[model samples]
Target: MSHTPTRLRVVRAAAALTAGAALFVGGPAGVALAAPPAVVAAATDHSLHLEGAPNARDVGGYETVDGKTVRTNTVFRTDALDKLTPADLAKLEGWNVKVVDDLRTVYERALQPDKLPAGATSNWYDVLGQAPITTALDLQSAYVAFIDAPGASEAFASVLRDIRETDGTVLYHCSAGKDRTGWTTAVLLTILGVDRATVNADYMLTNEYVDDSGSSISGSLMGGGVKQEWLDTSFATAEAKYGSFDNYVHQGLGLTDNDIAALKAKLLV
Candidate 1:
């Protein structure tokens, strides 16, 4: 299934800033109000079943290098919540999801506004705000642009900051759950000390879960499969700019070492 939207890139570019209100926590001022730490429990269902959302899954249980494992049910990645069924809502409610980080642009959100679990606050984090915001079209160029964009770091940092401060599950997603969402997952796993092999493996699972049936693959490099190069490019891009992924998180994303520690404290066992 091709993820690219064959539209004029320039048109989307002009519409990016006007799409939604930015939701990143303002630095320093946000620190004083950060929520108290909350312990996470095991997920009732690690993988979700939803008519509207096909790619939702818990990003927990992977072991860190120090033998600790990521806390289950605390973090989730999904495609979109606009099509969620009642059963899906009930399931999410059972998990007590608190934060729904929608990574889509304003136009995308307007087209399919999320049907979040009752009381789960939604935050708009435009993953492509610093790039030439196209849906699925021109993914390679788009991915490179995302890596180069200064706002990518801030966007990533805000999600991490939110994860550290939220008392419940933080479900983040883009349109297909494989690009913007995928990169976010990769960064989090890296911060937790998950090996590159495991990180790449987890990323490839999107292909297994997201049903791309009937989607066209024209102009797509991997025929809509989460290409290995896409993952490679993300890491390589980080390496080129920040010397390493860890540095990228700390320096490029403007996250302090203490911030990373707080995230691990909240999300890892």
Candidate 2:
């Protein structure tokens, strides 16, 4: 049922719920729930989890301004699932996901690929190319990125529009779920009216996941630019380009009125 608790209870309950699900520590939702205490004490701390998929987390239990919470299981974020462990596959199987909207480019998906739940629809919505985001890539680049990336807002909006009419969960992702993934996620959260700092914090979480191995998401401002300062500049760039996070939703991503409304309805409630 929808979370209809009274105002006082709503805030209190949401605070408690946020503590339980720490994704909101970044933005609207991004943190992966830490394993149980017993699991942490085990020799192999994450044996019960998927190692190939870094930073995977459920976007559940964030308290909205109103009393309700974002339902668990409807949304997820992670590095590409192309490298799922067998156990990871089974974990997804348990989530009853109906769609895996992969945001990687055609080349990336063909090269690395994602692991969808058995019988789940593997819808490829390329929101952008696999290239790093920079002035080096133009509007054509953005459109191509939109086309090649997963969770294309225009396309995902279509998916959201239809999914709302149906009854199963949907998950979308890219390699880092940062640029393309970040844009898609930022848009969804923006519709929910989440603050900018929280949204940018969520975007910055990519730095925590992949080893970087010198391969980068956005291009270097200069050589050796993988330093933390450069990453900060990147978020600063997003802020400058979009004016505000919400503007990125309406302007950069071009999420339509109907699309924004549908996402807020599904995610916020």
Candidate 3:
């Protein structure tokens, strides 16, 4: 998951330019400015506000296409929990989190394993374990691989199954919670009928929550701020391969209509 510093810089610079252009175009007179993605996400913030895991938040409060809202305190998404403070652990306990799903690689787990709250069990699903380690710096390709890589669908399906079947709150995370975890969030939200624009806004909220300056090169590459296109690539890949997101969930991940129905019943309120 490592990339040359030169490539990283190039990719980051391109992202910066794209962001700058957005700002510039929106700043022109009479061109009404749209709300930033973070602003939109604030309607459903439900953040855990953990000092160690700033990106941790509830995956709820989003209105579905049919007008129901996803329930809060049922499921959470987060960055690595290896650095949680005692107070953070208390917060998790208060939230009644019963299962913690880890989406990191085996090497990542060994480097910094999660510190679970009392009574919470951990489940590991290495999203990239079955594929050769990729050295490419393209975030889009990395996202597509999350869907196409061997064993990836199984791992993702397992996490969803855990969320669907677990009795209490479940918190799932990767090292930095933006790449693998972001895709997981997107898939879940889409399945629950959240619109594309809102899902993209939810994905972009990582830039406001995660500070990756101190991260390792791999972390920087994986958790670095996301772009709309990178997430779009994942959705496009899923559609191209499986015909639709529902098909991707059913065929790609091998979930049944009953399984998806169960997930919606549990997640939506």
Candidate 4:
């Protein structure tokens, strides 16, 4: 059926966004965060779901502390869209996403080039999954690494920067949109001071996006993978390296104070 408010509420009640971040490798020293309530709600509210793209969703209608809302049909995160059904293709076309930013590395892109929606401006940006942020780097290790990296935040900020400078619906995603997509959206919302638990909750929604085998799809885009440890590790790394989600978005993304103010003006009401 549809994603529930209870699934989203778990994030705000018990998930301590910062406490479990210390345990990036998955131990008792850190907190266990969940997906943000707003992100999950957005996926539900907009009815942006696709029959083929499991995680494809728009980041719209989220409330700001100032009582503003994030614009709808602006941002979406999902997997490679090289295999969309005609009906699903029509749905994305209806959304009119103009800029499709492919976050996959060159190698991944070559493996499965996106079948971008007609008329969408396709761009590329590498999320650097292979390049470890630290010497003891391990791919698919735990949520800790995923939570603690600056690179993902930086990449995510670039997308935000482009949104203001240009106009169009921008859709972005990596191989699965789990590690990179999760981190990027988490940082963006956190910059708006949404909440820590909510951020984690948003990150965890990958489970819902995927299937029993982990890797799943919505429309043409896919999410999750068999035994993918990087999802958690990537997040943990961001937390350990950057201090907090907001810090990662501001400092790691290199978003200047003016840039942030502009983002606030553009996003918040």
In terms of lDDT, which candidate is strongest? 3
What's each prediction's TM-score?
A: 0.79, 0.60, 0.81, 0.69
lDDT of each: 0.67, 0.48, 0.72, 0.54
Q: lDDT value for candidate 4?
A: 0.54
- Cα-based RMSD of the predictions, in order? 10.0, 12.3, 12.8, 10.2
lDDT of 2 by residue, 1-64 (tens): 1111221211110000011122111123222222111101101111113576765654444444
lDDT per residue (tens digit) for residues 20-81 in model 3: 22221000122121111111222544567788898887788688888877767777899889
Off by over 4 Å in 4: 1-43, 129-154, 214-247
Window of ten residues with lowest summed lDDT in model 4: 10-19
Model with the higher TM-score, candidate 2 or 4: 4
2 or 3, greater by TM-score: 3
Model 4 C-alpha lDDT per residue in residues 1-269, reported as the tens digit of each score = 22222212222211001112231210012222221223333324432567766667655556655555665555677756766678777777776667887766555675567877777888776555433434123334323533433344455666777655445567877766665666667667766665555555666666555564543322112333323334445545666788864565556677766666665555544
Best by TM-score: 3
